[model samples]
Target: MAQFTFEGDFEILADPQIKLVESALQKKGFTNGKIVVEPVGQKGDNYIAHVKRFIYEAEDGTTFNMIGKVAPVAEQLRLMMNTMVLFNNEIVMYNLVLPKLNDIQNSAGVTDDEKVRFPACYGVVTEEPYEFILIEDLKEAGFEMLDKMKPLTNESVRLIVKDLAKYHSLSYVLKNSEPEIYESYSNKLSNLWAIVGAEPEAQQFFESGENDLFKMMHDVSDQYKNVVRGSLTQITPIAKKIQSYEKGSKYSVIQQGDCWNNNILFRLEEGKPVDDVMIDYQLSSEGNPAADLLYLIFNCTDHATRLEHYQEWIDYYNETLDHSLNLHGLKANHIFPKDQLDADLKRYGKQMVNLGVLLSSMLERESKDALDMRVMTGDKEKLWENTMAQMNASLLDISTIVKIRQRIMGIIDTALEFGLI
Candidate 1:
């Protein structure tokens, strides 16, 4: 059999990265005779990293599959993403955090089926300038991705929210049951938004879109124009605000930083989602869980579906969270309390509005217009000058812009009605 087959941009994967995967598999008692690698999904669309499936055939003919993620080979993207830290954080999540979480739940007598599930991480390599993660490939268990372009059904949204609740509640358990572990894990997690705040180019990128977004909001209401403009200009500080861990608050959790549709995989039966598994923890950090809820709604669901089920979605998330916490022998009311969660959502949900408009442009933009890391730099003016024109072109997708605008306007109207903004 041929050895070390590759597809897509897997060509750029260097020998050291491959060796890391082999070492990870070897540690699991899988001695390989030959290995095959194939690209799993679309690339470049993911501006930060590339993922591929690795198939290993043992000397006895037994074979297993692993999913691997590696930092981008593109020089510009690598520097822009601060991928070293991102890779290290994810490695810590899989190697350190997941095991602690599983142990905490198991000791509480929680059954594996009822608890939140994540892929088994086989091995991790954190050597600087060449990091890769190897984990169990969930596709072998029939998990699949929903089409990101389509609006999520309520059923799909419910499944996502439920799983998110289960995942987030573990942070609560860790904090109360195992404070030291909680502090250690929480402290290590890098706030993903802080990266954007540090990068002057990134800040200006958000600023450049203000006028375009303001013009889009002009027809909605005069106040909307002000709201949109204010949110856009203050993107850096708002991002910083969410980064606060707010220790001992009911609202805080070590949140899944990137909660878009593409970051999740679902197990569907008869065309309906039954369960989901989360992937891509590169942006994981401590923050208000509501930001995750709002991010998923605004980024994944179309305006119509989100508006139709906004309240129901919140109810479903809180219900699931309550269930998850009770399983850990912790009372949600005493520790987190459902009523406080409602208040927290109102406080932090504007992230959905601010990042919703800013990020949706990237989500909807043509693949060609995806951030070209090649020219990215710390020099704000140079980065802005090099990027602003093409960035505008990317955000000009009418369908995407309209849908995002609808979600933001809906959020604004509700905020105003509730005196939230």
Candidate 2:
């Protein structure tokens, strides 16, 4: 085994180049420490190197445990300047949001409780080619990552909705309170979906895949063709809107650009759901709160359960949103009125539909391995194997599918009522 050592503060861990990172850490007050990289997790585009526990003695002869994260050069380069910008934004969010959350807890007059909505941020450091973030290790907190295809319990769904409401409420409050900072950071988000939709090759792949999804869409309801077609056509345009902020929407919040179950961590108290924690602020930006809601509901939940509890879930989310906003000295009608939320839900429903198509490619039973590997290596057999494995894992009960179809139909009917198609 090989060991790496660094000096200075722990923030210099972000540099892609190891030597510079070591020098920066040394400068920042982390001398007399050893660094060891361990494989913890990997996504399609990025790999995480977990810096194992470190021992630091205080003046009272007490030792504290700390950890760090480092990314490979390729992943570091993908976002380029955008990566650094996101890092800085997260640092600001941590400093601002974390403290305000504490204040909210003490005020008693506060609307939303901040026990476990956001991750515990130790600190963040960014230095050019190397960027490192020190965060409370989630694994150490007794939370386990759920499999991508596993169905969430009804309680899990409710908790997720509650946390999302609080998250959106916070962003809306921040936007009104600090427009300059919100606008500056929110403007940098990249809409990769729109970009891919524009590419000829990507379009072809989606067009072919659309037929399969259409089959699934039609099996659920007769009216979905037009809805699907319209959504598919609007993919590029919606992508553009997502790329920039829309005018006249009074309420704005930092959108958890990616809000799948995989990105969430849950803390269970005595086997009952107690708290939910959100991660991956890399995709955080200002956008419609409904976008995150739709994303999570459509992508993470099972087709059957979602369809069965769709209406209830929506209502619950609204209630949560209202409650959260009220705590921040705001009202749901002021931020997202019933009529506005419905309209946004319909318009944004199309975006979710478009996203569903993209997500299905990676989420369906046959696509599991590809997703696990975090890459599309153009291997059809592997894709099919992974997809089937997911399907098997999901069990795909007939009753579940039928119920899901009916629920999906209800959503389509609502969209039709709103003239979204």
Candidate 3:
């Protein structure tokens, strides 16, 4: 992890970056300003970007707060992630896809309160190899991330899935009404799963797959190690299948792709999450709606919650999506009928099992070491060695191990039930 303090690293701000900010603020009616940029989140957490909180004070004493997300300054990191097509997709998302979705919702007579909200993008620099987007700071707008350290309750899960339904439904409507536009948008996006799955390092890691993390599952089942191994091996095949965009698929939409607790921010009222917004669209791509739902379920909820109310949660998502589709003068049957949605779940559910094993371990692990490991992109053996090291460190925590086991077992059970294993 690199140390980035406001005082020592203030010189890192280039004149061009400041100029970009000034141009963006001028659009919002701010004239002649003094701009100060400070580091915002953990530098280790964001391996691909330099996230800065920008404070612009106008000559008239008016102030504007915006987030400037810029590409990594490190040449090696930037080149590696760029080859994987990471940063530019987000630039496309905030600039193109989100505004289009908002317009589609507005035309459908959806109220602002009910609409799926994205932060307002003030400006974007789409120059290749130096992409960044400036959007309204959600924290200043009263939105906060659910504590990543705490387990999510049923209510938080409900809000997350419900919001995801609305987000997916708009794309459904667009796919049905204007296939060309939807096709173009989906084509422009990248499937992040494919990038990771296609990595020789990842595949080799899956092969050499006896995990210390899985050792903690001794009380759970004898098959735990094999289940983890087999699921990881399947990531590449499933990702290739999804990214193929084969003909005769009944439905697909541009998913947020990354759906962990960190990427989602919520608005709280009386200590409960009332409304939520999603951020970090670098992984956005065309996929089954089930991809997003099952990912959220396995990563965010406990085993008991899913076992008890899985069907209910699925129904709720469909109902919300259906209602939104109806408001847009479209029938759910024409866009995403119930039967197709069911098939999608069965087909794509295995991918969630794969993701849960990898991501749950990641969530529980030490953050700084994990970021340090990310730089070893090309070395398959070294990356796997470091990954196992991180997992071993996390296994020392009994509570984290319990949660990891619960999630892994739940996913494995669901995958078996859905005939995905």
Candidate 4:
């Protein structure tokens, strides 16, 4: 009913082509349609356009709404490899994993309610080098992005932990029940972190912030050198441990490889948070669940609030695991005893040290006036001034150096508890 202007460099289909597509739909039983393109949103190199509800004057005048995604040729080409990787992952999930699981369910004759934990896939269009997918637009479906730095309510935390447990449990079952499939998926998850770590850009980024972060972790290094020595001695082993986990018979389901808040979508039903849908599976592959949990906590929660609620969140994760395992006819004790889980929590928790340093550098706030603060292309002196100004503002609270120190000390304490250092 409402029309809006759409602007982008994406190739717009001609009126004739639009008519052909519409006619094709009409022949397939759709009717009374008018196409209006509405600008949706843009991220990185892609743009989303919406084809709103079509009103049909015939056959009860039902309205049908669909979405279309388009992007510039250059942008599409730039991200082609990344896009292909995600598409391949989706195909594997749909073709190899979902069907097998469904078959198993049918053979067992289990009538219990089982929901597929993924976005509804309508179809994909792949013509030549351009590829686009029509998917259920979660933004239009009443889902709000979770804000970083805001501590989640106990209820919301519970739901997240519960969903994670179920996800991990499913992966565990598939790993043992179908080893070949599990191995196939597992092989896809190579050490991507190693590649990133080896990059010169990464080295420069780390070097830029190392001195400030080192001062923050100074206390921990001083107080618990004996304990954290191992963690400090080898970044490679730490990187590997942070990437993979070893649980009895269960192989890791793809770690939501990137566990930042923005990558997760929370769905609320009846005024209560009920579900979490993880997106951007490009980096996903076999990994430790603890790494995901720790990464999310460090990146999403403010450092000032984390220590206060850390234990409670851990307990919530355990409770979710217990419930999910019971539903799947598995027991938590059989997979990870209470003692072992605690130990892993402590040991693997040191991985948060690397993550904390990374988050501090990346999440520092910059004002619009600080235009020269852009990390990629700004002049070095101007960017340094802007970064220092931002750090100074943070320092007025307790000094930027002190905050970094505190985070490092926190990591040391965790490492000591886990006997990792």
Candidate 5:
């Protein structure tokens, strides 16, 4: 028998992780072959996990492909990103929550076309320090993520919110039908922001970003800038309230906590979106639908596009939610009414503005300035010493500063206009 070979970026993985992947392959009857695993997407596309695509070839000319997401190796990076908590939450999402949700949809006789799309977990390894999740590669199935730098078109926006309605509605379904099971998983998922809020580094990191944020506001009018300055005080408190277990409200559903362009993949037909698959549930948790709505809108689309269709998108999401609820003989008006939904939006909008600035900073980084894989992979003492130091306004180039300001300020303008701020 020929020995198995691991190639490319797969070499970075430790022995235990590589063995786990080999074991997973053996379980699929793929033994003794060339297994090539390489990093996925470009640098800075994702900051939290080290994602890679694994390819296997057999002598009979068969091919198997999948994606593996491993916890970042560096202890400093782990602390900075709340890596362990986020990884475990996603493991729960795939291994427990999503499967049950899909079964509920199937038992209701909902067609595959209408069900929430998620990649299948081929296997998972959580032994000690070597933790990784292997999932079906959406790229092999013809799904592609939109570019982070580009604004989503109106068509893309509609499909996203439309599908988002299906995804969020199921949480309500699971809650009503199987409250025990719902609570079991929801309770286990940790709130990343809430966890970080208690840390000493959190304040300094946020303040560093806030300083850069104001510097970017140089070209903005005094009226809007002051409105933003006033809202700053509410940010820390709002971050705590979001995904808050103590204050969990009736309107909260399991939201796709990171609902931006890159976290969702689209299957396009001739440049038009036909369907989408939800990815990156690392930050997903029991949260308000309004938070998801605001995230999708403010982070994915710019101010001009939103100024044209902001109200329309909200209306459409509510309508789609109502339609999806009817699947299980339930009523959205009874469970999550339009009035309640609108109230939640107003409640969460300010914090959305704060997070929008953070997202834009990551999205607009040029390739040269993109996250250095080495730093993330390196382990060193004094982990928290440089928290958010790189984002210092004086350290950034004029071009990047302008881009971050414009993207974030655009979100602010839309929020203020919609009365969300």
Candidate 6:
């Protein structure tokens, strides 16, 4: 509170959470400075946590910046979002998993340019309700999140999967090199959907959304609707199967888990891809590596792009994964063979496409219609306990519906063509 200027209502951070930030800043050598706190990104861009940018104007005129994923102050929303599990998963990734991964690459003398790039964690506070992850701001390095509604270009997709392969290689390294340590992380990450499936309230929330999705499919033929249902309605059970400890653990790697456009940030140089980093690990879980590719390919790119490069992207990811493993003296065939990867894709492909359909709705929502967020906020919940009246309003937009429809059907088409479904 001394020299900190809260740009908005985030001044609510006057609690012990503020002290955590102050301590991290002070440790970084900013003994005397003004810290400006403000929110980052739009409503639809992020939902689980409030992403805030903290800028410290040091006495010497150089400003230091950090990004904080802060829990909402509203307890009702906190319970609904289950920040307890989500934030704890992230804190462990930053505090435990990623550091171990960095050590493996460093010991191998991997160059910084070739290693998996993640933001440096300054501090992590997993104290319930007040949980937040404080890390270096990627924006300082010119990294930015792509537009959620648009398709990622082939070049951009290459940069994404290339980094994904490298990051996943570390997972295999940690698993083979230090099995005990890797198992600990695998045990720690809770399956978000498995938890949702257990809670009646959470189940209702998704069931409502699922109902709307089925309504959208009313326009399609029964053959295609069955294809849609193969994954869509079975979401919870399929996710449980994938995230469960027994599911393909031999071939599993620490997947980005929720691999979508919004969770990845790219640094563009003159309108083309240069470097990119994956952010938001709340859903990070141990699963078949194929889950990441299927999720990203279906959810991030358009049908046209996937048709031209779907098989190529999978091969590219395999090549890159093998190369990353080779850098540290591990062999992909010895650990995750190409045949196994293809089998995993066939096994998990439809379930992952189901994820694309669900994410497509939320991520593709027009800015003006993203107000379903109101249902999550306590204040809005208080006013509208019976909000079914406005439930499908956003999903009703013609253009938004088209995007969602195309993604759903196109996802199925590609899977069918590849013999995955």
RMSD of each: 3.2, 7.0, 4.4, 7.3, 2.3, 2.5
Please report, as a residue range, the 10-residue window in candidate 5 with the lowest summed lDDT.
373-382
lDDT of each structure? 0.74, 0.57, 0.72, 0.50, 0.79, 0.78
Off by over 4 Å in 6: 1-9, 245-248, 371-395
lDDT of 5 by residue, 147-234 (tens): 8889999889998999889988999998888888888888888767666655556665666666667667867898557755634444
Clashes of 3: 0
Better of 2 and 5 by TM-score: 5
- As a whole number from 0 to 100, the lDDT of residue 83 in candidate 6 is 72
Lowest summed lDDT over 10 consecutive residues: which window, candidate 4?
Answer: 42-51
- Looking at candidate 2, what is the lDDT of residue 340? 73
Clashes of 2: 27
Which scores greater on TM-score, model 3 or model 4? 3
Worst 10 residues of 3 by lDDT: 1-10
Give one digit per residue, the lDDT tens place, for model 6 in 50-117: 78888888768989988888876677766666678888889989999988898998899999889889
Candidate 1: 10-residue stretch with minimal lDDT:
1-10
In order of appearance, the predictions have TM-scores of 0.88, 0.69, 0.87, 0.65, 0.93, 0.93
Clashing pairs in 5: none
lDDT of 1 by residue, 34-109 (tens): 6777777663346666678888777688888888887765445565567777887798899888878878778888
Best by lDDT: 5
Superposed by TM-score, candidate 3 places the C-alpha of residue 336 at a distance from the truth, in angstroms, of 1.2
Per-residue C-alpha lDDT of model 3 across residues 167-202, encoded as one tens digit per residue: 998887878878888888877887766766565655
In lDDT terms, how accurate is model 5? 0.79
lDDT of 3: 0.72
